[model samples]
Target: MTLTLDGEKIDRNRFTGAKVENATFHNCDFSGADLTGSEFIGCTFYDRDSRLGCRFSRAQLKDASFKSCDLSMTDFRNVSALSIEIRECRAQGADFRGASFMNMITSRSWFCSAYITKSNLSYANFSKVVLEKCELWENRWNGAQILGANFSGSDLSGGEFASFDWRAADFTHCDLTNSELGELDVRNVDLQGVKLDSEQASQLMERLGILVIG
Candidate 1:
């Protein structure tokens, strides 16, 4: 059974195991609410101001899509989010550690200081997202869309960016050791103080059409 809520005031309601589809909520407060095993498909949680976004602390959001929602300071720790789409949300300081997602797309969002360590993010698309100072180590970002994203001051070891477009991202002071950079395109991407492996350096030189003479 699925529940549809539109233009309603659902402040702090327990929506465990609930299926919300095509709903639009405004000025609703979901702070400290437990949405364990809940699925929100094509839902919109809109809040005009950036100071106070919708809160989903420790909510179980598996296989869901939160479109155009403001999740600033939203606690997403240890939540299972498989095949989720958190589109265009402000997730500053959002804790995503220990949470696993597959084929996920978190596009057009500001997720600064998002603790996303030791998680599986393979086949994920985080393109055009502002991920400044985000904790993204030991995670699987292989074949992920990280273009035009800000990864400044973050440790990105053990992640693979094979076939990733680096034309518009900022990697200033980022640690890229032990990471895979398969055929990286470093056009317009900031790489100051970034440690690259031997293969990564070769790929950049090869893109520049510069061959080393013996």
Candidate 2:
């Protein structure tokens, strides 16, 4: 029996550097709250009964981390998430639309950062999100909605991309070695500066009907 703390209103609160576990925050408003350096483990933010998810929209999540958490169908829209880490978490169908991971220095000058490794991101909405130069390796991206998303210079190595569309997002300058490039057509998607292992390259060549000799 998993005991859960439900319907807790922690919005606009400063829970910086705090650690929470096994808590259910269904429909809870965490908007504009400071959760920097906090860690959440085995926590659930989605309510299956009402199909509602907790709101982390516009939250300060810099360096905030989550591990083994069920964040399915959660709202993370427009959050400032620089250096946010999510490891081994079940974030299926979570919304990350409009989330900013970049630190702007001046006009046309900025750098992005985030460590989202080993998480399940299947069917998650990242449409039009900019995640350039971030650490996003080893995640399961099956059926993720990444239309018009920019992932340039990001490390996406060792990821599982079954049923993923490479043409829907930008993968230029990305390290995609040892990843399953499902349906990734080399002729359709731009692969400039994209790194792939020899085996993956050969597999892609086979898809284009090109006979890879040796």
Candidate 3:
């Protein structure tokens, strides 16, 4: 059940349980289509235009560019996406668990309620993005620029965030247990109502030049 969409324009179509594995879509357009429950394992989407509910589980999107489209609720679990550009898209409720994103630019996108566990986001720029209530546990975010982003009520436990820029970001009521914070800068970022241990809070405050008197 494999479908190959090469240089095709498929607009407003509903494709469910469609197997699109090992296919190559060159300059294809799938705007406003409902591709829920679709599997796209080992597929290549070069300069494709896909939008809204395009689910892809265990897919390998290597060298793909989903630039400037609405790709909400798109499942990317266990997907290997190298050099992908998902900039300025609505990617809410998209599951990216166990995915590796290398040199990817997913800036200014909405990732509300998205599950992104065990993903590699090193050197990726999620600047000015809205990530409300998203699950990002055990992920690596080293050298990533996440300024002015909203991460309210998100679970970021056991993640690696060494030397990242998180200025003006909100972490209200978020969980950050057992996460790596080696030399992280928390200046101008709100830390109220955040779930952290005393040692973690003290270490974070000490980095912010706050002297604790007993």
Candidate 4:
């Protein structure tokens, strides 16, 4: 079934297996909506609204702005987006594998236990965000700002985090195997009680004060 939402206020609607392609939503509100198993390809969501359990697979969201919305458990795997603003949203348990986010502002968002594997998160701002137990494998986070964020128990293997500021961020128990940590500020961040390998610990000790004598 094909659904088109154009300049309408649709609240609390449960749509499953619905195809909404190339539609434009202007100032439409979708608060408290259950859009599970719905596909939105090449759609543009303009304005602020909350969406719960919005399942999307192979959807294209170019130039979509999800500002100030609660998108908890929104599955957006293999989606491509440009200039998306997901600011101040609760995105816990959201899946974003192979998703591309260009010039996105996801600041102050809650991404607790979210899965973001092989995603492009370049030029994104994550200030004061919480990403506990999130999976961020092989993601591109170049030139991102992650000040005062919580990344405990998160998997960051093979991720590119070049030139990012991690001041006052908590990375306790997070995996950093083969992840790029270049140009990151380790002085303001706390790495105490973090699970690190011998090579990772040696690299961190070079920046932080750790006396090692054999």
TM-score of each: 0.45, 0.93, 0.53, 0.51
Number of the top candidate by lDDT? 2
Which lDDT value does model 4 have at 64? 43
Clashing pairs in 1: none
lDDT winner between candidates 1 and 3: 3
Best candidate per TM-score, number?
Answer: 2
- Backbone clash pairs in model 3 (N, Cα, C under 3 Å; residues 3+ apart or in different chains), count: 0
Model 3: lDDT equals 0.57
Q: RMSD of candidate 3 to the true fold? A: 11.0
**Residue-wise C-alpha lDDT for candidate 4, range 1-214, written one tens digit per residue:** 4344655655544433355665655444454344434455545443345433444445545444453343444555655544333443444445555454433347544334344565556655455555676666776777655666677777877778876666646787778788877765556666655555566657777667785554
Per-residue lDDT tens digits of candidate 2, residues 18-112?
88878677777788889988889888888989887788999999989988888888899999999998998888999999899989999899999
Clashing pairs for model 4 are none
Separately for all candidates shown, the number of backbone clashes (residues 3 or more apart, or on different chains) is 0, 0, 0, 0
Q: Kindly list the per-residue Cα lDDT of model 3 for residues 47-146, writing each as its tens digit.
A: 2354334444545454444433434445565555543445434444455555554333476543343555665566544555556666667777776656
